[model samples]
Target: MRLSICAVAATLFTSTIAAPTSKFDSLANTSEESESEIVRRDGGDGKYFHEPGGDNTLGHYDKRYFHGVVSDEERRDTQKHMVRAYLDFFRKNDLDTWIAHGTLLGWWWNGQRLPWDFDLDTQVSGATLHHLGEAYNQTNHSYTSDDEQVKRTYLLDVNPWIWQRERGDGMNIIDARWIDVRNGLFIDITGLSETHPDSQPGIWSCKNYHRYRTDELYPMRETMFEGVIAKVPYSYDKILTDEYKESALVNTQFNGHEWNPNAKIWEKTEETLRQEEEERKKKEEEEKKKTVEQAQMA
Candidate 1:
């Protein structure tokens, strides 16, 4: 969900290239050595190399600027594919997982998506994490439609840490990522560490990180998210309260759009007037200077 404004404007403002129908076929026919080593060469400032971590700290540089090059349509398609892949995996394996945080917010209404959603979020159990890492790590799965134009591809990227059981503060419990390589949209999967029976109920706890009991998380319930079957924490009210307080549900303006608190949708409107006014004043000042110069020349 980290976007560099300059990067987005530069990449998306231009026309899109039609994706080649035979692209995946060509990739499939290529040698395994070459395919395994396919790396995106680095350029520009060292900015692109920075690792995206908690809260997008690495990706957020200028408050106004974001990184990555992708169109809105392409971005949406990427996210949709990611969600589909996760659901497919869940259905096939019969694994129990649920949407969390902003993702859960999307589920609060219809099973559809929020127009401004930046990324996908979900959680899995430790046992389920092991099952995926062992069988589906770094695997490519394709979704095809009867209409050839709608087909898309995705990859399951399972991290190695799922197998390692080290109790420490810095470790991340998440085991895998559902990636839309073509557009870079991804879903983050974190594990809910199992607690001993003697431990208190109602306090959510994770041994790999700071501990919290189930009470901290309160209730969990069944919910549908991203047009798929899933579950979500019942403590969503408390969770949002801590993170955004009442503002999480408050209608506010961002990037020339009004974000609806109740519906969690971003609507475009007169919010862009300020940006337009600023651009207009700048042009007027430049024009006035040119007029003065012309009179002196005469």
Candidate 2:
């Protein structure tokens, strides 16, 4: 079933990290809260999510969680769970958001994440951004698969510089993130607002300078992505074309992978590529032989 901007704001609550109750609960809570709370107290140097061993200005994924690069199957499975949990959390928290960037493009193709993408992207309205920060920043949401075999936890962490509407220092282009604590994979959540409200009437933009018209985004369309109901921009085609150009929608082959319509997914096979190369060589040989035969006849 489709879900729209108006349909968001559901009251269902997902599981969250239970508060520690051991004799060391106080110490554990202090340590656990310090990571994010310290950044907030420092007035934020504009960096939000920090890498475990790296600098604090890390933009998207946290390397510590990965340990090492995961296999393709693991990445896809984790991403799918991440997106579904994000949608569910937003709905329950009464927040409005939609798939954006590469994630949206994936939806257009087959309601799935792009095979080449290692992360996901989403967007929230300016108002929703405030609500998220004020109400759900640094909150965790946990969910289980339908069969209850797989369980995943996600953290909704908001950028402290969210109030700075303009694209000031560029350190906080992303307004927030839905992070999977297990693998450190996360969904970038940018916020759209009227950066120049007095002059730019209908224009909307994020800190990253990605702009869209009011009508192009309002009354968002609803569809499913990664097996969960989600929202998308109203003029998705136009928006995507503006960002990625017309080829994005029409080009089926990308990054060594080709769309398999029969399977309804993109596939990459070394054997298939080898076979294609052999077939191409055979055709070229046939054309050369025909040319030689024609010359002899003449």
Which residue window of length 10 is worst by lDDT in model 2?
Answer: 17-26
What is the lDDT, from 0 to 100, of the residue 189 in candidate 2?
Answer: 89
Q: Scored by Cα lDDT, where does model 2 land?
A: 0.72
Residue-by-residue lDDT tens digits, candidate 2, 1-298: 1122112324112223221112221121233344457467534654665554443223345654655556668878889888888898777766678899999888877778888787788988777787777788989888998789889888888876677667776766877888888878788888887766567766878888899887787677666677787887778879988999999887768877888776677898676778878988999999999999999999
**Model 1 residue 103 lDDT score:** 71
Q: Measured by TM-score, how close is model 2 to the native structure?
A: 0.74
C-alpha lDDT (0 to 100) for residue 262 of candidate 1: 58
Look at candidate 1 and tell me the lDDT of residue 127.
57
Please, what is the whole-model Cα lDDT of each candidate in the order they appear?
0.52, 0.72
Winning model by lDDT? 2
lDDT of 1 at 99: 72
